[model samples]
Target: RIIEGYDGLGIVSTIDPGQGLVVVWVTPDTQDEVTHILHFFPRALNY
Candidate 1:
């Protein structure tokens, strides 16, 4: 899903509700991407 900020700056993050896995696209918005992923999956991490 695409998550947009209050200023419209956003990133695309995919969340697998069934598997409870949130996949985030890392590029320009690496920080935003991670934030988005965590927003969807509070316990998500690379490890």
Candidate 2:
């Protein structure tokens, strides 16, 4: 699913069933803006 920020910044967070990993894609400019997205999925936890 895709989640967007209040400012219209966002990221596409998806679980790659075949890879067994959560893939996150965002624009280079919004790399820092994706912190919240990363937090939602916690890098410490497994996808």
Per-residue lDDT tens digits for candidate 1, residues 1-47, read 34444334444455777876655444564666456645774554662
lDDT of 2 at 11: 44
Q: Give model 2 RMSD, 1 decimal.
A: 4.3
lDDT of 2 by residue, 9-44 (tens): 554455776875665555678777566555676346
lDDT of 2: 0.56
TM-score (C-alpha) between model 2 and the true structure: 0.39
* Superposed Cα deviation of residue 45, candidate 1 (Å): 2.0
